[model samples]
Target chain A: MSAAASSRSGARFWTWLSVLVLAVLCLVWIYPFLWLVSASFKDPLEIFSKGLSLVPNALRWDNYVRAWATAGFSTYMLNTVLVTVGTVLLVIFHTSLTGYVLGRYNFIGRKLVIGVLVATFIIPAGFAIIPIVDLTKTLGLLNNRWGIILALAGSGHAASILLYAGFFSQLPKELEEAAVVDGAGFFTIFGRIMLPLAGPVTATVAVLTFLAAWNSFLIPLVLTFGAPGQRTLAVGMLAFVGTNETDWPGMAAAATLSLVPVIVFFFFVQRFFVEGVAGAIKA
Target chain B: MSLSHSAIRPSIRRRLWADRWIYLFLLPTVVLVASYTIWPMFASIWFSLLDWNGFERAGRFIAFGNYAEIFADRLFWNAFANTVIFVVVAVPIRVGLALLLAVVLNAGLPFSRSFRTAIFLPVVTTAAILGVVMRFVLDPASGPVNEVLLQLHLITQPINFLGRAGLSLYTAIGVWVWKWLGITLIYWMAALQTIPADLYDAARIDGAGRWQRFRYITVPLLTPFTIIITLITVVEATNVFDLMLTLTNGGPFFSSEVIDIFVYRQAFAANIPRLGYASAAALLFGVCVMAVIAAQIVVVARLRRRVAEQ
Candidate 1:
């Protein structure tokens, strides 16, 4: 009876201790973002004088408007949308077909091709800069939106394809067979049937690819350096900080603006995002 | 029989034509990949051998000279060391924090879902944007971090976070840990979801404490996810270019110069564009990263098999 009572007490103590520790950690983890939002609304005097404030004396909504327009963010946002959408569409279309071929078909060098694609995942994107730049210049793609799109399109990650392949393999091949028996052409079957069936994985790919392209800085930075007007939001935001003399309020405002689209996308499609990533990890 | 065999051959050819739709469907993707990615990979190999700038007309091939020079450069070595340090330190902390958060969130605490969501918010934010935010937060005098520390009497003087030489890497690592902990947490949470609840129940009934259950049951089962995520984290850390560029710019000294930034500086910022040398450094960086990832994947796979056997 005494032992049972002691054990109960110990469990209570542990539960409380765990809660305290987790609360501290949660705060540490979240403090930066809270600070970011706080800084955005803070008066310049308060920001500079008080360092950081959790709340501001007055809300400065103009900071966001000025940051958006003056930083050439309108153009940057447009470019990012175009590039991200273009890349996601290309990735979904190309990777599905290629992943389908590699997943479902028996062909020459199929394994080797898949292996090579997987290997490129670890090869840092930096290594290809010279050749990419040279090729872009040669093709007159330098400073062009197509340049950014093509550069991102070049590397299809094998893991993502393997993931699609894994899911595809589990899918009953009977559907494709039925389409074939119905005199549906191979492309038609792929386009209508297989593509539609790949919706979940497609969502995953779209979110991951979109975030990747949207966050891409170095590729576009080096590729589009000369064309000042052709900057993506990330690159533009960086240039904004530099040009605007590190305006803390303005910078924070821009940061928030740049994050709005992604955050919105994340909230709406977060279920798919989590499942997609989790599925990939499991495989 | 010979006539029948010839007839079958033509039918096979006709069937292939009928199936030509699939080939046509694959054509655009194949063309795009071949032109953009496959061709550029080959082009990189070719360019790595030449002494050509973006505009140079004719280039002379220098066999392994670039590689030799890359091995000799001091900055190349520093960048390599920084990349290694960043990977070694950041990957473990990120993974560790993530696993801990996953456990906490999965403990069935009230409002845990909201907690998980809040923690994971930073993962969705832009790295470049976070860089700017971190710059403001870590500022010596005017940053909230130092202000809080000063108020709490944690330090006698304001510590120069990103402005100091040795401390910049730590600052970058802190920013990295905060931004990355969210996604890694999600991965862990997902992995945790797959763990059978009965395993924990059995451990509890066997008089195992929370820590013991965590160590024996949770950790062991979670090993596969941990190994995979560790490798992913390491790969991502090694490519730490944009954040470093934005947060510290490899400054207050050259303390934070990873190989990616090193290549950029040499190729673009150098008084004379040593495009050849820069390409060589980049290639060396790539080779080193690939080797590390390959070795890690092998080790993880072997460990996973051993665990399964047990």
Candidate 2:
């Protein structure tokens, strides 16, 4: 073959290869999700009974109905929603405030404060889990939604602050200078000018925080173990598994229900979310 | 006092007073962080000194007893070994696979967006529940994989992927790699994008082969990302408690019990819970994680200085 023909064939081979690789990647990534849905519809007793074609014996809504009722998914979901919302709000408010001030002002101990926040990531706050539990108990926060919310909100300080601060630093000083000239005080400028303009970072932190709070398990497990009624969906599913052992259909349905909300939210904001998280890492 | 010195004192005081709003803005975060994050961190070290079962309000101070116990406990060492093995085996593979995937997807593959989303689905979705769901996939009996294996005559009997003592930790790590691979891929893509394309073009023009270009340019340009990615991996890997809890529960005769599982078991799972000992294990684990991160920070800081100097 001529050199040009060989190069063309090589290019063609790569195109087909990429297509094949991407197709397989998509399949493998999606298979578990598909299996989850299929098993959710299977009969609890009849799951995998037909030799594992990943097909349900029938499309039974019973598992979902049963899981929703038996496992008290409604309460878990409510608890999760409360914790997640509170965490996102608190984190955004606190970190955005901190980031804005740190970004705009040259202040004493600013470097120390930033260093501490960043160091928290390295130190891994988990060493303090026991003390945190005791502190929560002392503060009467254990088994309370507020306990989990406050704890989670206090975490993720470094990344969120950095992301917000990056946004804050990039804003033209003229905008803030105009606001300062308008007799707007700190909170005023922050609320009206800074926070409004920090939409992208806020959205990024909110989505990330929301997903984290929603999916957290061990925190709720440790804090709310004594108060089973207050369990989040993640911890509730653990208990559900303990009780409904081998109830594959019901378990799968429970898992699916827990994941669906986040999955949907992720799909909508994914393009932005990926860019946001990657962007934060760069900062 | 000299005129300039005296004048500067008042200005400093005025600056401090005028910046009260900065303080106020930072007050909630400072107070919340101090109470919830900082306090607990210091408190853990104190807790590690006591001989307590965790339920009681107070306990005797047996200085260094918990740490001594941690050092001596066979299970602790087993867990330490297991965790080290996990980091050694899992982190590189996860980061490596992610780089490969990100490189391919960065080439503008067909359906790149959906592919990124699909792979990243596991990261954002309820991971613990996904672990529980994965149990179904890896179920020895009535699992699709087993059925396929049987159909293909790969094995005579259903293999217990999660139940087997040897395979449990590695299996869990496999799941870990799969779950978090997308985030790493995203990071790699972001880092790769920062490198101008013309460098590659220039290299090609200079008669540099693809391997030479990638070796000299891509690898050098990727150092900061590699450092950051490794840092993220270390942090993420050490925090795999919930997944472990749901996946194997550190089971099959404790073959898979990493330090996180070890800590949980001592604090919560054991019939004779030793909270102090658990704290010691956690402290050690935290120190190790911090040491790794501190090293990475030095590298990252050096990289930053080099970039700045350049």
Candidate 3:
């Protein structure tokens, strides 16, 4: 009895210790975000004046407006929104069709198509930069929004297929069979039946694609080389920082500005984001 | 019945003609992939043969010469070497830390949900933003990181984390780990959730200690997630460029130059670009990546199969 009671106490002790450690971990993770928010409020002089000042001497809201004007962030924001929206539209259309076909239909080269698509995921985009440039130039897509849209769409095929395949495989084939029995063709069946059932996964694909297109840096940098006006928010912000010679206040403000769209985007759609990543993990 | 079937043949032809809608559905994807990925992939292979400087209208088709030059170039080798080092040092540390954190988080601690969210917020933010934000936070002089370290008496002076040759790789690794840890944690957390609670209860009833239950039960169950995360980490680490570009710009002396950065520099850095040489280097790098991925897939698949058999 005595030994059992001691062990029970030990368990309680460890549980409390675990909680303490976890609290500390959480603090560490939150520190950077807090620091970012705090630094954005500080002026240029106070930013580097003291080491690790948690409170700024005064708040500066104009920095946000100034960073926007100086970096031409409004243009970048417009460009990013265009590219992201375009990528999402293309992804939905392409994945729904291809994923539907690959998922349900029995076709020749089905396995090969799936395998090849998955294989491309491992193909590094950097190595293909020169060739991509050449192809884009030939297609007259360089520094063009269409170029960004196309590249994002092409690279997204594998992930979209993977996700859609998983979801579609779980879908009841009886729906399609019944639709066929009712004299509905492939188009009607896919449009009326499958697409509706794909709501969750479609949302997942949209969120993922939007995030990828929004956060994309290198591709836009390469494609929009020498044309600063064509740059996305990410690339524009990067150039802003690099060009300004470690201008901490301006850079912090710019960084914070760059995060606003994504943070807002994710927060609104966070339900789908969580579900998508969670489902991916389970798979 | 026979007469009706005979009349249906023409109907079948009309229906088949209308089924061209499938072709319409497939057209956009095929056209885009062909123009961007398929065409560029092949063009890259072809361009590897020509010694085309950026200014040139055309260049001599010196077959295999670029590949030869890549094999002979020391800077190419240095970049390759740095890539290997980054992958070797970063992936394991990042994955290991993630797993450890996941296990701890899974053991039923307070504020676990909020903690997970905090860790994952970084993963959602743009890496471009992270590149600049991290530079400020990790600044050697006025950076919060060093200030904390100094206060703790961990070091007498602020260390040149990104400037020192030996430490530069580690600094990049730290940033990479921060960006990636949340993803791994998510995977492991998912894996842990799949584990049956009764197993741990049984282990407790059998007088097994906490570490024993974790080792015998949690670790084995986590193998699949670990393998997948490791493979993803390897691919991600090998492809790291933006952070390296933004944080250290691949270095004070190319200390942080990975293969991707090297490829970027070769292709577009100079006034006269070396597209052909960059192509060869990229191909070589691709080969290395493919080989590693292939090995990982085979080994992990076999292990999974063996576990299933048990």
* Candidate whose lDDT is highest: 2
Each candidate's TM vs. the true structure?
Answer: 0.91, 0.94, 0.92
- Going through the candidates in order, the fraction of native interface contacts each one reproduces equals 0.63, 0.70, 0.65
Residue-level lDDT of model 2, residues A1-283, one tens digit each, is 9998998999789977987888887787878889889888987666756455577668999889988887799888899989999999999999999998877777776898898887776668568677778878998988999999888887656788987887898888788668767887677888988899999889888888888889887778899978987899999988998888878888889888999999898888888888887886776
lDDT of each: 0.78, 0.84, 0.80
- Among these predictions, the greatest DockQ belongs to 2
The model with the greater lDDT, 1 or 2, is 2
- Superposed by TM-score, candidate 2 places the C-alpha of residue A57 at a distance from the truth, in angstroms, of 4.1
Candidate 3 stretches greater than 4 Å from native: A169-188, B1-19, B301-310
Winner by TM-score between candidate 3 and candidate 2: 2
Every candidate's DockQ is: 0.53, 0.60, 0.54
Give the docking tier of candidate 1. medium
**Candidate 1 residue-wise lDDT at B59:** 65
Query: Once model 1 is optimally superposed onto the true structure by TM-score, how far is the C-alpha of residue A49 displaced, in angstroms?
Result: 1.7
Better of 1 and 3 by lDDT: 3
lDDT tens per residue, model 3, B208-254: 98899989999888777778778888888887787888887788688
Instruction: Give the runs in model 1 whose Cα sits over 4 Å from its true position.
Output: A1-13, A180-182, B1-19, B300-310
